[model samples]
Target: MSDVAGTLPSTRPSFLRLPYLRWGLVAIIQLFLIAIPLADRFDVQRNGQVVPLELVPVDPRDLLRGDYVIINLAINSLSKDLSEGDKIAVGDKIFVGLQAGAGKAAQPVVVSVERDNAGDLAMSGTVRSLTENEIRVDYGIDAFFLPEGEGRIIERLDTSRVLLEIAVTEDGRSLPLTLLVDGKAFQSDAAF
Candidate 1:
């Protein structure tokens, strides 16, 4: 067969000329971008220790961002003494050691600037602020997205009964695993 201009068509496969092939490549790239983070979280969930934390649920809805619970862990603020004389400043990476409480939740027992000095149940966090008597940290597990219309249910529940289950890796990386409301698992609609 000849081209409209009476020229023979090139024999080499042109990827750009094949719409399916081009779209397939695009789809594969997107899939990989999504899969990588999910796989990392799965690894943490599979091998890390489960640490339960008492959650202080704050505003659960953002009109512009859809439905999700903003989680504030009781352990977010620790006494400066927990650092054991280590100088802590804003933006410093620190590890908070935890011990099982009388209930299912784990309580922060100590804080260290070094991972080696932290306990077996340590969580990695970034120091957000520091005062003369207190240090505030962010664990990066502060939100739990829920299905549409479910944020209200969580907001209405007793805040004292809410708990967050987190999987903490040895390196101090953490993944929010579940939300417990009155000791029952609260399902989330988030895909990752």
Candidate 2:
């Protein structure tokens, strides 16, 4: 091919002219994006602490998404004494203090806007709403995602007898690790 000056055609854009440089740049970008989620998962799986929470039932479907159990945790509403110091309002970051319950169960003992090392276990959450005697918190571990048709089984489960395995960080944020029914891992059961 020839140009208007009877010269050969140019190669490619100057920025991407070097194959190795172009590929390296793309690889770096991909690694950066992928690392964020991987790090979060690793943090929970490795150093995060585990806390067993009682599960409460709610609708099992979302119109926009599909097949996920809405987690209505038993600890969502707690007593005002758990608020620690002064009264907390909506949108405040709080920690749900827990204590060991009967056999692998964790009970919410208190809720405090500040971190207290005295609590046996603490999971971070945001205050959704509060009242004189009660506080509603959102722990962000509010959904249990499952494969297609699997959520139906969870929805039908008696939540009063179900327990959710949550991994909580020292700072109080938590992630749902598993679902257990009657002290047995739900995944191992054929009925599930």
Candidate 3:
């Protein structure tokens, strides 16, 4: 062996070489952007009303995205008659009125295209795909990110007994709180 020690190559990226002030400014901006949405979600969880909706889980596995289950709420479909302006089109912001169903389950009572006309306990989502028969809404709570192997367990669960506990604001914003399996909280911050 030679007397000289082997020097390892530097692994730091070029961005790391920037001045401290520049890096600090970039970090502050990044944190602000990330915190804004999370702050809203957190606020809803703290003050929003809890609504339990039936869950229909679909298996989703991606190498880059890790594990998560795509969910379809039982309250997704609305058969209510819409007036001339009440018709929800694709990309429209709509409020879904919710009411307590059998055994304290939350069910979608109606879909109101207008915000002012939206009743109490309304949840908001953007209409993804719409047809005369049905309007598909993306409620932002569509996926439950799971840790490692947990996704498989949720995927194999009997969907009838599965419930998604969500927090909804009075103004129609919603944040998913937990996934309940067989009336038990699988992953949750709130009681089942």
Candidate 4:
């Protein structure tokens, strides 16, 4: 009762309110830190298809699996040549010619492949310096690379195992294109 009017009561906001602005600032900073480095990107092609992607190279917090490779597809990897020679036979250094179009790379076509004396498939030409039009490639499917029985958990050992030079036909124009595995292809899934 003695000068109680001069003193304030506890009816005001708590300490939590004061810290809300500071906490919010910290949260904003944290969000920016998390998002900035996530701006990296990549691209891939399958068959003659091109796949574009934007990704973060971090440990990758996934929706279900936690973390994994987000492979983007630029082409249908199963749609090889759109014609023939689907399998890489024994001792064949397959030659693949890339036709330009589907993506920034080539379209799709076949190049000459020869069997080396070591029983390896060797590419017969040169598109070694690839640009927008075409690329020549030697098949790395030789036994020395993949050995055959490793198609399960290891379909590709390195870029040499999966990278193939391909050619494609688009609107009567043939071009050379580079192709890669979108992963392995199963038979009869010929959306081809």
**lDDT by candidate, in order shown:** 0.85, 0.76, 0.76, 0.32
Worst 10 residues of 2 by lDDT: 183-192
Of 2 and 3, the candidate ahead on lDDT is 3
Superior candidate under TM-score, 1 versus 3: 1
Best by lDDT: 1
The stretch of ten residues in a row with the least summed lDDT in candidate 3 is 76-85
lDDT over C-alpha atoms for residue 42 of model 3: 81
The prediction achieving the highest TM-score against the true structure is: 1
- For model 4, residues 9-110, the per-residue Cα lDDT tens digits are 767557545788779879989998886533311111122233211111112234443332222222222133432443433343344334434323333344
77-159 per-residue lDDT for model 1 (tens digits): 99998999898889999999989665489988899999989988899999999888999999998888877798888888888
lDDT accuracy of residue 18 in candidate 2: 84
Tell me each candidate's TM-score.
0.80, 0.79, 0.77, 0.23
Residue 82, model 4: Cα distance from true site in angstroms? 34
Residue 166 of model 3: what lDDT?
87
Q: After superposing candidate 2, which stretches have Cα over 4 Å from the reference? A: 1-20, 62-66, 102-104, 188-192
lDDT (Cα, 0-100) at 135 in candidate 1: 97
Candidate 4, superposed: residue stretches over 4 Å from native: 1-17, 42-152, 155-160, 164-192
lDDT-best of 1 and 4: 1
